[model samples]
Target: MTEGMGDKTEGAERILCDEGLRVAVGGLGDRVVVDVRDGTANRFWTDTSNLEKALHGEAVRIDAHGGYCVIEVREGTGRLDLVMEGVEHKHCDFSTGDLADAIAMVREQSDPEGSLVERA
Candidate 1:
Protein backbone atom coordinates (compact mmCIF):
# COMPACT_ATOMS: atom_id res chain seq x y z
CA MET A 1 0.00 0.00 0.00
CA THR A 2 2.95 2.32 -0.29
CA GLU A 3 2.67 5.44 -2.40
CA GLY A 4 2.49 4.82 -6.17
CA MET A 5 1.84 1.07 -5.74
CA GLY A 6 -1.86 1.74 -6.28
CA ASP A 7 -4.68 -0.35 -4.97
CA LYS A 8 -3.89 -4.04 -4.90
CA THR A 9 -6.08 -6.21 -7.07
CA GLU A 10 -6.38 -9.94 -7.06
CA GLY A 11 -3.09 -11.51 -8.11
CA ALA A 12 -1.42 -8.30 -9.11
CA GLU A 13 2.21 -7.50 -8.41
CA ARG A 14 3.26 -4.15 -7.05
CA ILE A 15 6.49 -2.43 -6.31
CA LEU A 16 5.94 -1.17 -2.81
CA CYS A 17 9.04 0.98 -2.64
CA ASP A 18 12.17 1.57 -4.63
CA GLU A 19 14.26 4.20 -3.04
CA GLY A 20 17.57 3.33 -1.38
CA LEU A 21 16.06 -0.15 -1.51
CA ARG A 22 13.56 -2.01 -3.63
CA VAL A 23 10.65 -4.06 -2.32
CA ALA A 24 8.05 -5.74 -4.49
CA VAL A 25 5.13 -8.00 -3.75
CA GLY A 26 3.30 -10.40 -6.04
CA GLY A 27 2.24 -14.00 -6.69
CA LEU A 28 -0.85 -16.19 -6.43
CA GLY A 29 -2.31 -19.42 -5.10
CA ASP A 30 -0.61 -20.34 -1.85
CA ARG A 31 2.28 -18.05 -2.64
CA VAL A 32 3.01 -14.41 -1.84
CA VAL A 33 6.35 -13.06 -2.92
CA VAL A 34 8.15 -10.29 -1.05
CA ASP A 35 11.24 -9.47 -3.04
CA VAL A 36 13.80 -7.11 -1.58
CA ARG A 37 16.69 -5.71 -3.54
CA ASP A 38 19.35 -3.82 -1.63
CA GLY A 39 20.88 -2.46 -4.83
CA THR A 40 23.24 -5.39 -5.05
CA ALA A 41 23.46 -8.30 -7.42
CA ASN A 42 22.36 -10.45 -4.49
CA ARG A 43 18.84 -10.12 -3.17
CA PHE A 44 16.82 -11.30 -0.20
CA TRP A 45 13.28 -12.42 -0.69
CA THR A 46 10.47 -14.53 0.75
CA ASP A 47 7.31 -16.14 -0.53
CA THR A 48 4.56 -17.58 1.60
CA SER A 49 0.84 -17.90 1.53
CA ASN A 50 0.54 -17.90 5.31
CA LEU A 51 1.27 -14.25 5.85
CA GLU A 52 -2.31 -13.31 6.50
CA LYS A 53 -2.77 -16.26 8.76
CA ALA A 54 0.51 -15.63 10.50
CA LEU A 55 -0.71 -12.25 11.57
CA HIS A 56 -2.61 -14.16 14.23
CA GLY A 57 0.58 -15.51 15.80
CA GLU A 58 1.11 -18.50 13.57
CA ALA A 59 4.82 -18.32 12.87
CA VAL A 60 6.15 -19.07 9.39
CA ARG A 61 9.73 -19.59 8.33
CA ILE A 62 11.49 -19.81 5.00
CA ASP A 63 15.05 -20.75 4.23
CA ALA A 64 17.02 -19.62 1.18
CA HIS A 65 20.59 -19.77 0.00
CA GLY A 66 22.26 -20.25 3.36
CA GLY A 67 19.91 -17.81 5.09
CA TYR A 68 16.39 -17.68 6.38
CA CYS A 69 13.57 -15.29 7.27
CA VAL A 70 10.66 -15.70 9.66
CA ILE A 71 7.38 -13.86 9.85
CA GLU A 72 4.61 -13.98 12.40
CA VAL A 73 2.44 -11.83 14.57
CA ARG A 74 3.78 -10.99 17.95
CA GLU A 75 1.89 -12.50 20.82
CA GLY A 76 -0.40 -10.16 22.77
CA THR A 77 0.40 -6.98 20.82
CA GLY A 78 -0.35 -8.46 17.39
CA ARG A 79 2.64 -6.67 15.92
CA LEU A 80 4.50 -8.06 12.96
CA ASP A 81 7.30 -10.41 13.92
CA LEU A 82 10.13 -10.45 11.41
CA VAL A 83 13.39 -12.24 11.97
CA MET A 84 16.10 -12.76 9.39
CA GLU A 85 19.65 -13.91 8.97
CA GLY A 86 21.63 -10.86 8.01
CA VAL A 87 25.05 -10.28 6.49
CA GLU A 88 28.13 -11.72 8.19
CA HIS A 89 26.34 -14.05 10.53
CA LYS A 90 24.07 -11.43 12.00
CA HIS A 91 20.71 -12.44 13.35
CA CYS A 92 18.24 -9.58 13.18
CA ASP A 93 14.85 -9.34 14.78
CA PHE A 94 12.22 -6.76 13.89
CA SER A 95 8.95 -6.35 15.73
CA THR A 96 7.01 -3.82 13.74
CA GLY A 97 3.58 -2.38 14.38
CA ASP A 98 2.73 -2.72 10.69
CA LEU A 99 3.91 -3.91 7.31
CA ALA A 100 5.39 -0.57 6.28
CA ASP A 101 7.65 -0.53 9.30
CA ALA A 102 8.61 -4.11 8.56
CA ILE A 103 9.62 -3.19 5.02
CA ALA A 104 11.60 -0.22 6.27
CA MET A 105 13.37 -2.44 8.76
CA VAL A 106 14.37 -4.78 5.97
CA ARG A 107 15.65 -1.92 3.86
CA GLU A 108 17.71 -0.59 6.72
CA GLN A 109 19.27 -3.94 7.46
CA SER A 110 19.74 -5.00 3.85
CA ASP A 111 21.52 -1.81 2.96
CA PRO A 112 23.08 -0.73 6.23
CA GLU A 113 25.86 1.05 4.38
CA GLY A 114 23.39 3.18 2.42
CA SER A 115 25.01 1.99 -0.78
CA LEU A 116 21.81 2.29 -2.73
CA VAL A 117 21.23 6.00 -2.03
CA GLU A 118 23.17 7.10 -5.08
CA ARG A 119 21.54 4.59 -7.40
CA ALA A 120 18.09 5.47 -6.11
Candidate 2:
Protein backbone atom coordinates (compact mmCIF):
# COMPACT_ATOMS: atom_id res chain seq x y z
CA MET A 1 0.00 0.00 0.00
CA THR A 2 1.16 3.56 -0.64
CA GLU A 3 1.96 5.71 2.34
CA GLY A 4 -1.12 7.92 2.45
CA MET A 5 -3.32 5.49 0.51
CA GLY A 6 -3.22 2.78 3.16
CA ASP A 7 -6.20 3.99 5.12
CA LYS A 8 -8.27 4.36 1.97
CA THR A 9 -7.43 0.95 0.57
CA GLU A 10 -7.80 -2.68 1.55
CA GLY A 11 -5.31 -5.50 0.90
CA ALA A 12 -3.11 -3.01 -0.84
CA GLU A 13 0.65 -2.98 -1.27
CA ARG A 14 3.08 -0.78 -3.13
CA ILE A 15 6.46 -2.09 -4.21
CA LEU A 16 9.33 0.18 -4.99
CA CYS A 17 12.32 -1.55 -6.47
CA ASP A 18 15.90 -0.54 -7.11
CA GLU A 19 15.09 -0.69 -10.82
CA GLY A 20 12.91 2.38 -10.36
CA LEU A 21 9.59 0.76 -11.18
CA ARG A 22 6.62 1.53 -8.97
CA VAL A 23 3.80 -0.97 -8.59
CA ALA A 24 0.55 -0.66 -6.68
CA VAL A 25 -1.85 -3.48 -5.85
CA GLY A 26 -5.11 -3.14 -4.01
CA GLY A 27 -8.79 -3.87 -3.92
CA LEU A 28 -11.93 -1.79 -4.10
CA GLY A 29 -14.92 -3.66 -2.73
CA ASP A 30 -14.99 -6.69 -5.08
CA ARG A 31 -12.28 -5.86 -7.58
CA VAL A 32 -8.52 -5.93 -7.51
CA VAL A 33 -6.47 -3.27 -9.26
CA VAL A 34 -2.82 -3.22 -10.18
CA ASP A 35 -0.84 -0.32 -11.52
CA VAL A 36 2.65 -0.31 -12.93
CA ARG A 37 4.50 2.90 -13.65
CA ASP A 38 8.03 3.93 -14.34
CA GLY A 39 9.39 7.43 -14.13
CA THR A 40 8.77 7.68 -17.86
CA ALA A 41 5.61 7.25 -19.98
CA ASN A 42 4.96 3.58 -19.29
CA ARG A 43 2.23 3.72 -16.71
CA PHE A 44 -0.47 1.07 -17.01
CA TRP A 45 -3.37 -0.29 -15.02
CA THR A 46 -4.77 -3.83 -14.87
CA ASP A 47 -7.84 -4.59 -12.78
CA THR A 48 -9.20 -8.02 -11.98
CA SER A 49 -10.57 -10.10 -9.14
CA ASN A 50 -9.60 -13.26 -7.23
CA LEU A 51 -6.60 -11.24 -6.26
CA GLU A 52 -6.67 -11.84 -2.55
CA LYS A 53 -6.47 -15.52 -3.32
CA ALA A 54 -3.36 -14.93 -5.43
CA LEU A 55 -1.46 -12.43 -3.40
CA HIS A 56 1.73 -12.49 -1.26
CA GLY A 57 3.34 -14.93 -3.75
CA GLU A 58 1.78 -15.87 -7.04
CA ALA A 59 3.36 -16.60 -10.42
CA VAL A 60 2.55 -15.40 -13.92
CA ARG A 61 4.86 -16.45 -16.71
CA ILE A 62 4.50 -15.79 -20.40
CA ASP A 63 6.18 -18.18 -22.80
CA ALA A 64 6.23 -16.35 -26.07
CA HIS A 65 8.30 -18.96 -27.84
CA GLY A 66 6.32 -21.80 -26.29
CA GLY A 67 3.02 -20.21 -27.28
CA TYR A 68 1.30 -20.30 -23.91
CA CYS A 69 1.33 -18.61 -20.51
CA VAL A 70 0.72 -19.93 -17.06
CA ILE A 71 -0.92 -18.03 -14.22
CA GLU A 72 -1.21 -19.63 -10.83
CA VAL A 73 -2.25 -18.53 -7.39
CA ARG A 74 0.16 -19.32 -4.61
CA GLU A 75 -0.57 -19.20 -0.93
CA GLY A 76 1.71 -19.63 2.07
CA THR A 77 0.85 -23.32 2.17
CA GLY A 78 1.06 -24.14 -1.55
CA ARG A 79 -0.14 -23.38 -5.07
CA LEU A 80 -3.84 -23.65 -5.78
CA ASP A 81 -5.60 -25.40 -8.64
CA LEU A 82 -7.85 -22.67 -9.94
CA VAL A 83 -10.72 -24.99 -10.78
CA MET A 84 -10.89 -26.35 -7.25
CA GLU A 85 -9.85 -23.03 -5.79
CA GLY A 86 -13.23 -21.63 -6.87
CA VAL A 87 -11.83 -18.86 -9.01
CA GLU A 88 -14.24 -17.84 -11.77
CA HIS A 89 -12.84 -19.33 -14.94
CA LYS A 90 -13.31 -16.45 -17.34
CA HIS A 91 -15.80 -13.68 -17.86
CA CYS A 92 -16.52 -14.71 -21.44
CA ASP A 93 -14.19 -17.64 -22.03
CA PHE A 94 -13.28 -15.27 -24.86
CA SER A 95 -14.94 -12.25 -23.30
CA THR A 96 -17.75 -11.98 -25.88
CA GLY A 97 -20.20 -14.74 -25.03
CA ASP A 98 -23.56 -14.40 -23.38
CA LEU A 99 -23.39 -13.92 -19.62
CA ALA A 100 -25.60 -16.91 -19.07
CA ASP A 101 -23.37 -19.05 -21.25
CA ALA A 102 -20.38 -18.03 -19.20
CA ILE A 103 -22.15 -18.90 -15.99
CA ALA A 104 -23.21 -22.20 -17.53
CA MET A 105 -19.61 -23.04 -18.29
CA VAL A 106 -18.74 -22.51 -14.66
CA ARG A 107 -21.74 -24.55 -13.61
CA GLU A 108 -20.81 -27.35 -15.96
CA GLN A 109 -17.31 -27.53 -14.54
CA SER A 110 -18.74 -27.84 -11.09
CA ASP A 111 -20.18 -31.23 -11.91
CA PRO A 112 -18.32 -34.39 -11.02
CA GLU A 113 -19.23 -36.10 -14.29
CA GLY A 114 -18.66 -33.23 -16.67
CA SER A 115 -15.91 -33.38 -19.27
CA LEU A 116 -13.79 -30.34 -19.89
CA VAL A 117 -13.42 -28.77 -23.33
CA GLU A 118 -9.77 -28.63 -24.12
CA ARG A 119 -8.15 -26.60 -26.85
CA ALA A 120 -7.06 -28.60 -29.82
Point to the candidate with the largest lDDT: 1
Superposition error at 66 for model 1 (Å): 2.8
lDDT by residue for model 2 (14-100), tens? 332213333343333333223333332222122232333233345432222112222343333322121112223221011112222
How do the predictions measure up, each by TM-score? 0.42, 0.28
- Going through the candidates in the order shown, the clash numbers are 0, 2
Instruction: Give per-residue CA lDDT, model 1, range 11-50, as digits (tens).
Output: 4445544554454545433334555455332223343334
Q: Candidate 2: which stretches are off by over 4 Å?
A: 1-19, 40-49, 60-120
Q: Model 1: what TM-score? A: 0.42
Residue 86 local lDDT, model 2: 28
**Model 1: residues >4 Å from true position, as ranges?**
1-11, 14-22, 41-48, 75-120
The 10-residue segment with the lowest total lDDT in model 1: 1-10
Model 2 lDDT, residue 111, Cα: 22
TM accuracy, model 2? 0.28
